[model samples]
Target chain A: MADEEKEQQKQGEMEELPVILQLRPVPAITPVEEQFLKKFRFLKAWESSMPTELFLTTYAQSVRVLLCHGGTPVTADTIRCLPSLQCVIATSAGLNHIDLTECRKRDIAIANAGDCYSENGADYAIGLLLDVLRQFSASDRYVRQGLWPVKGAYPLGSKLGGKQVGIVGLGHIGSEVAKRLVAFGCSISYNSRKKKPSVAFPFYSDVRDLAANSDALILCCGLTKETYHIINRDVLLALGEKGVIINIGRGAIIDEKELIQCLMQGEIGGAGLDVFENEPDVPKELLAMDNVVLSPHKAVLTPEAIVSLQDLLMANLEAFFSNKPLVSEVKDE
Target chain B: MADEEKEQQKQGEMEELPVILQLRPVPAITPVEEQFLKKFRFLKAWESSMPTELFLTTYAQSVRVLLCHGGTPVTADTIRCLPSLQCVIATSAGLNHIDLTECRKRDIAIANAGDCYSENGADYAIGLLLDVLRQFSASDRYVRQGLWPVKGAYPLGSKLGGKQVGIVGLGHIGSEVAKRLVAFGCSISYNSRKKKPSVAFPFYSDVRDLAANSDALILCCGLTKETYHIINRDVLLALGEKGVIINIGRGAIIDEKELIQCLMQGEIGGAGLDVFENEPDVPKELLAMDNVVLSPHKAVLTPEAIVSLQDLLMANLEAFFSNKPLVSEVKDE
Candidate 1:
């Protein structure tokens, strides 16, 4: 009787094996992670497109888990079609592209690599700050063009010391930026969901209030329904004339039209942006402005951050399969 | 017989007046300083060219003070001609253009406005630091030339944090550079004539040792017999591959040809130079290299610093006439 029951248990387990679909291409993994993934025999990984019909047909008999990176937004139709889909893992901090509400209704587990790129983001933010404050880019241009006259007027740049640096979100990236700015002799203040008792910086309840008080405002918040176009014309105007705005957050957090307008009007002194509302295609108006500094959204693409991400993701997978608690589990409420 | 004696005494007093010859031109002074100069009625303050004959004629009138700014260099012949010239006030630094030993033999007091430009020199040093570390000028070239691609690969730049900064001179400008670098989180080390007890930074006994240990070596010592060509090709080679050199000190303190060669060979990573061996004309070959950053010798010509220098000079003049000590008196020895 015990042998018959064991046979039935083995059959039940064989029927419950999950299938994995990788929608986006990732860079090649390191040798250690490749060996780790080899132990998951019950799972089948497919590098397939993420369309509804394709994913449904591809993983018909098994519970599906889709791994995705950045690109086009995922819709409710795409989520609903994956009948056996049990989880969705976004290998990025931002989840605006995914249909979170649909996944919630379907009782799907959702997890994101939120804090992986925090340090890289902060490093790039500081780089931009130094670039502008030191007038490095402008001076280089002067010499390269051979336009530097023997007795020409020197650029009178101001020191970064004694400047008010306002952080819009006190999340991982924001906190890191604050820490680095502190070293530069800047006074820090922030606006977050709630005042964190652990942090010593002054907290502002409103974003405009933070901007009004700061000599430079940095946007490091998430993009959500409430925060979409949060940094609008009013906020930019409130920042006043010697103010600089640095946006490393999601592009949707800022109103692109409003930012370009303010920059053109000189309502704000300057801007250093690494992301735009519709990236890979920045607004022509913003591109024309001399007061703005632009960088492609490669701030978080550092090799160090990428390696850390792969390691963390693989560890999470290992823990999940071993019936142990997952490292970064998402609640299904 | 008493009236005759009084008349004789008055004549003797008249004969004691010392003639003053003003060479070149000076800016108009404030009423306060002008009044102070009036008390020195023994000084003639006549404006004249420093031709050999004119200088001799002026010196023949028992001129005790010679106020000179610019023209030809003063030679031994000119100094001998000015036998009655008891003092020479150069309105600039660098007595290399003046015959110092000749003036010493004639027992003439030689004074200069050397310390007047100290603050300006310091400010320039900070400017060079900012330019090189931040890569401002290079980025500007890419931006202006419209060569900025969506993801252009510029050299990876490092912040000033966790780096040892070695100052070749701990004089006015080096001290100021130290103060400014403190904000950037750099560890300051310096080499000077003697260890400065008041300063908190570590002092190195040898410049080559300092260069070997430093991520950046700043030249801020004055050019003198003791310091001439102090930073030679050997020191540049000692600085190694990761090192940066910034020279705001006298250009003679560095061997320009060797420095250019070292920079070309990548013996040192880069250089930020404001002063070169030749005034108004920097080496065209050095300018062609991407590794070197160059600026004209106008670092100290900021409007604020220039105004401060003028104010200090006027204060010194006032003090000198009032039988008070000069603000920045140079010792003959």
Candidate 2:
């Protein structure tokens, strides 16, 4: 109850709060992020005028946890600068931005926004796919431009029922897509790095083989060396002219130039792209195509998803600081 | 067999083929219609310069079946003119164009498209719903117009999961919608003429009640005298400012003028309308709205559906001629 004892208790409590570091600002900070700020102190590298190297060096000794997002790269050089970093938690389903090899080498635990974005991402993928297949967006444009009365009937859209949908990457998002598609009477199959032992749908290790049998192909895998340019000209040709491509995964997974050429030549029927080779710089050719549906790389967005992400990031950080198991740890392959 | 006897036999077979009367040309005639022509004799009314009445009078005596599409109305007078008519087979799911009362009075059997268009209709309804709720069409327009770079990120869309969806007819299309929405983790309920005995979803006799409880309402019922203007201003108001209405059913099912007013005033959040009170002529006010997705009354147009429609029509015609139970018979209530 003494004044000296109370001061010491306050100091100890303050010292116990972990120092979390962020290289960049989160695209959209939520209430959950605000709550994290109140619970634990943060070292915002972006806020400081010092160079990133100087900022990291100054805070390296105390910083044990690193927070990252999809767009921000957490490279080996950045990891090397943070000598005390024990864990890296990402607010995205894919951890391509994080240097996984370095994390594994240093024994630094990695966690991602596991299933938090799956439902929304899958829903968006299906939305994009439907927009392309059903010509919902194109027909909407037709109606909006005062063309309905003048044009009589808009062009007929293809039915979703009985479509052979080939899912690339039978992970959480892909599984959700399959589940939704099944309800619409779409037949599901998949192509993944490895065949999922638990899945009942037919699996093809090669993307080209999957595309050959499918009326539509939905991309839902992470971006890595193995997956980059996976959907090249061969896959497009295998898909044929009636095939639609729905890419919700990272853009580079598909060869952008080849896709554009294929789409232009009608080698592929249509496309629904949520991401492109470059963010915010969509190919001008796609802007004029009625069969294409373009989104601003926002398949994994929704207020609900963002809130869950905040909770998940906080959970991983809390677990790491207390020496407990990370909630959604990503093992190195 | 002598050549003269063989020729006579072929002539007899040709004469035995039933005569089918067409009040109007079926637009976008498929190979199925061509097949019908090859198998049976068609009394094409438009081929003659005679008025429709005179054409019916001349041809009606021999016509045993009436072939019609969605736009062609089969009035009581038309049915009365055809004394030999035994059945009316419609190429659309809705029977609003056919005089059900007159058919019942004349003892003429009715066979609709049945479940041929249900899957496609439901699929399109879901597509429109997704487009409106997630702003897929609007976002596509944004991307196409090249505003993404200038206007940062598009606003976050509401997730389809965990939302309450009320279907306005627990029939084939409505049930399909419920099934699809269920897989998206949406809670489903419904409003129909009478509570379906077999359906597990909660039912409301009044549409306003359903709207009051649901975040979105998908209209999938046929337009009838009792159901016309069912989704009135009261229902829209009940749906609240955040509620979305998706109509794959006939126009006039929702009061068009009231709906326009509701949308303009923000009394309702959004709409995904495939049909209109005066279709081919959507309200000019809705043209610029991003929240509403306007389809060209095309919730049930697909090549697969058209092919199925042909098969159903032929089956019904064959069943009628053979005195067997109709495959897709619609009885008068």
Q: Which candidate leads the pack in DockQ?
A: 2
User: DockQ of each candidate's interface versus the true one?
Assistant: 0.15, 0.83
A1-333 per-residue lDDT for model 1 (tens digits): 599999998767655543355544534243343554454323323343455466565665564566666554656886776788767766776778888899888977776665777866775666566445544455544554566655354465445556899998888788878876765558999998889999989999999999999988888887878789999999999998778888877898999899888888899888877777866556777655556666656555555566677776776666655656556555621
Q: Write the per-residue lDDT of candidate 2 for residues A1-333, one digit (tens) a residue.
A: 999999999778867788888899775454556678667877789999999999999888998898887789999999999999999888888888888989989999889889999999999999998899899989999999899999789888798889999999988899999999999888999998798889999999889999999999999999988999999999999999999999999999999999999999999999999999988999998999999999988888888888888778877878887889999998843
lDDT of prediction 2: 0.89
**Residue B327 local lDDT, model 1:** 68
Considering every candidate listed, which one attains the maximal lDDT?
A: 2
Tens-digit per-residue lDDT, B229-289, candidate 1: 8898888888888789998776888998998888878788888887778755667787676
TM-score quality measure for candidate 1: 0.68
Candidate 1 error regions (>4 Å): A1-22, A27-127, A170-188, A196-202, A222-227, A250-253, A280-292, A297-333, B1-136, B143-165, B170-188, B196-202, B220-228, B248-253, B279-282, B285-333
